[model samples]
Target: MKISRVTARGFMSFDRIDLELNEGVTVVTGPNAAGKSNLGRIIDVARLTVASHAGSQRGNRLDVYERAPRHGTRRFRLAVGIELDQPWEQELIATFVRAAYASSAVELPRPAHSPNVSAERRDMDARRRLAPESVAVLLRGFLVIHYDEGARPRWRASWHHSSTGDLYEAVEPVWIMNLRNGGPLMRVKQEPSAPALSLADAWRRVFPDDQIDARTPMPEQLDFMGILKRLEHPISLRTGAHQDNLPLLDSVRDLYMLLGWDMEDARRGQVDFVHVLDVVLQRACVLTDNRRLPLARTFPLEAVGGEADLEDGSQIPCELYRLKNGPLPLRQRYQRIQARFTELVGTGFDVQATPDPERPGNLLIDVTVPEGDHEYPIAFSGAGRQEALFLSTLLGGDPGRVIVLDEPGVHIEPTLQRRLIQAPDSTTQCLVITHSADLVPVTAPGDLARIVRLAPSHDGSQAHRIGHLDPKDQTRWLQTLGPRDVRALLFSAGAVLCEGSTEVSALGTWWEGSSNPPSGANISLIDVGGDKSFGRYIEFLKAFSIPWVAIADGPALRPASDLHQQMKKQGILTATEPDSAEPDFDAWKAFWAAHNVFSLANVFGNDGTAAGEFEAYLKRLNLELLSQVDKGRSKPRIGAAFASQHPMPKEIADLYALIRDRLQPARLQDAQGEQA
Candidate 1:
């Protein structure tokens, strides 16, 4: 099943956070410490062993009332909330303070007759806030796990701490295991196993030492227990000698099969195609391009044609031909497939074309296999081709797997990576973790997930959660971050976020001009015309956590001014106008008067009354005149004063001319150069 939402409170770097997940595929990413992996672990906690997962009592007793960590005050808490399709669940954490426990400074009244007393105290306004015991009690119900190798873990309770001692857990209590990046899966090497009771059990059965506690939550059977009981083996669908394999396929096939496709009820559409000598045969699905598809199969070559003898489970070589009454186009068509990619390899799949000679002249054609190398028992292929074949198999055999590729293109090459990213959706929900610029398409932004930047924290020691940024700002932030950081904060959306083109370009140029530019792909600039669009973009930014800012000018700006009330009304952007900014027309006049301009007419002109204006008067004049004057003309409008009352420079007019004609995201010759 899909994880729809996640939330964390009082945990490590995450003081409070909530992330949303969509149907099909939801990509989780952020900086190395923006807490993306922490978020992933939070979800993994939900998937731990039922009886094994436990909430820490230490997490409950953190000192309340302290805004930040202090000398004596501690804030220990672990609160998690998970949302399901229908029946959702939440966990509230609380700490406990013993009746006998007392601090010298602040005293609470106790029963006169009884020397000892116990009361459930929730202090919302205490110095540090909740009592150490108060938070502990709240943590009693949720299942949380943190993976530290030294801790002796148990199925019911993983902690050993005393209320009387000072070793209290922090506000964040998550199971943290430092796996070496991705671990040595390719090499046949394994680590030494731990020997505690549960560790022994985990080691004997090859399970993780840590797990989540189940009995603490809803009386339902624990999600992890069932998973451990069922998911006892690797996820493989090939014929196996064991009995448990049946359920593995059952779980994957049942929960994450392509949204609308059913593998069991296979249906193949028929096609009647004729090749046009003037036209080229192409495979265009709306996933990559938005063109209407033929009602039935457009070409026989495109369909997953009838079976073939897959020799020893290998990818059968069959070159697809365009029947345009000609030979092959460039072989680059096959380049669309990842070089190392081999679908249905070892899955008993194969492909080939059967030439026809009996039928009339052009009436006869060659066959193509859509389910390439997927027909079982007739082939033999090696694991070397497994990566590519796995993709083809997922696309064909299963309609499509919710391809949760954590950098599917990482181990692959550049061209293959591009092709893999561009692969037709084929009902596949692709949740890809990538930071490749090559994967980005010039015309289509569909493949791009929303951009999230992970930047440094105020405190140099531990990084803080900086916020989302606009495409322009994101580029700067990412380079400061690098590969590991950017990989974690990736996400996708359905709308276009055209932040201002000028601002985006300015930011890009400013960054490039630096001794060092930021890492990761260049930022994507969506062209939303003015601050009104910027306002909407900002709203999207806040809602989704992408960082962005819109810059609009004034004088012509009115209530229609983007920097004004509109954004504040939408609650999208904060109106942080400099105190120096005037509310109306007079502010600019005063500022311009301070300058050497002869008069208000020098800048404002007759259109000086233009409110809600975004362009400068002089720049606008140059642009208007340039539009009227052809490129070949000797002189431009120059504001109707060419060589007259204080004639203007031809450079300014020429620049405006280019601005009006060119479509570059941004163009500047450094006040001395020209557009290429």
Candidate 2:
């Protein structure tokens, strides 16, 4: 059961946030202090919380009061609304432990200095989207959230939680995963103990008949980590303590009893316990949890041998580290060994437990890393590698489970982080909360990929995503931006870059109809941030094959002063319509203003009107008109008489009209006829 949405109120950074999750892979991104990690932590808390007053109504017991919202006349109605595709809509809520008011959390340098405080804090809004069935399983059934507030500079984290909800059952055969406790490792008050498997309960009993695939090599059979997890069950037959090194046969027999395996079948050589185990394990596939925690792949060979290719398209060179192992053909091996193991086990191969011959070492048959080597063990790599390996072993065993990864890139290289995102898994869905741009989809001019941006808010944290982007302003912004930072986020604010923030802030102001005197218009606008390092960002967007746009100002030209030409040379801006002017250096200020629909004052001659002191200089450009109002500062009243005489407000209003006249393509509209 994947989580369709995550809501946080009175949680770290999140006052009230609603984020829609994607089914397969949802990448969460933002700059350093944008609260990416905190946002991830909220998800961790939502899925793992126990009944409490802290985060969700089901928040962790210890931090319950700490994360609960402040008591209000209305209780502040802290809740995260989710729409699960598989299970059905179920109200998932958690109570906040504490809450801080906007006025209290933010110290206004000058209370009256700023006249545009939004009713919604920067991070206290909602980002909505529909939930896919695939993602539902991952969130509710199997989840891996990896966050590292653990180590400074670099964090390593992995987390997941599961509770039987209607969402889990819709996806059959694939059972929900158990709670994953890899977090801050906080020790909280223990409540009632979870119930052990009841041997007497017939319904609880697994297959009465057991059969082990005896022909399978010991190494190959026991090679997969998933093979061991099934063994993590309670033994119902035997009452004695589990052995430290019990004989394989005896242990299987004992577990058989505990699980309520038929005793008659065991004596008759029809080992029902082994049969059940084989049925559960055979042909089933597991996926690596490469998000928060990666996996490891190793070969004992020390010498460097040249290339080796196995009937597949991939080429593998022999080395101590084969970063790419390529996919292993499981079917071929299974077919080859089925007969041999069948003969060896005789009648009841399910009886299990076969001793190895010749070599004293345990027979871990055909245990080899697949061509797709996603794991990195620490002994060879580092502590982070070890952590990744452990996490992979724990979370990668099931494709049906949901995985939540908080800062999954901790200790991971940027390129590898990208690869982790690239790994293939059809059934498993991934929710990755990461600070690494490398892991984000490599966005182009117009790509859409699930991305969520979170930031601290006046009251709490807020989120923004693709679906929430306003159409009117957003369309124009995309024309300028090329859709780079705009992501198909589960829940997030559109991506924010140093310069991009300026536009988003402007858009936010304009969209809310509060551009000081108010733009007196509604526009869809979003920002596609870029920096010296857009390569990584671009790679992320492209990798996910997402559509988006990235907008940034071009560098100023000094000699030629050809702003357009210079920007084109820098690859910052590409003009569909080439400028005849080679180069003319405009001050950064001038160019920025121009992009914002403001014409330099010198561009228009004054028709001779008393210029507001602030716009006095601007009169030189538009003597009779103000190209663009300086937001709240400039008085836009003179147009009353100008527009009265003309069909439209000549200089300024005409331009505004021209922009408004732009007709968008039909596909851009939402189902409701609004811009999507």
TM-score of each: 0.35, 0.34
Tell me the whole-model lDDT of each prediction, alpha carbons only: 0.29, 0.33
| Per-residue accuracy of model 2 over 347-376 as CA lDDT, tens digit each | 111101122364343221121222233432
Per-residue lDDT over 491-593 for candidate 1, one digit per residue giving the tens place of the 0 to 100 score: 3111122233433333333333334332222223344555455454444434444433222344213333443454557653333333344344444433322
Error of 1 at 252 (Å): 25
Mark the regions of model 1 whose C-alpha exceeds 4 Å error after superposition: 1-23, 29-33, 37-151, 154-404, 409-511, 516-527, 562-565, 572-676
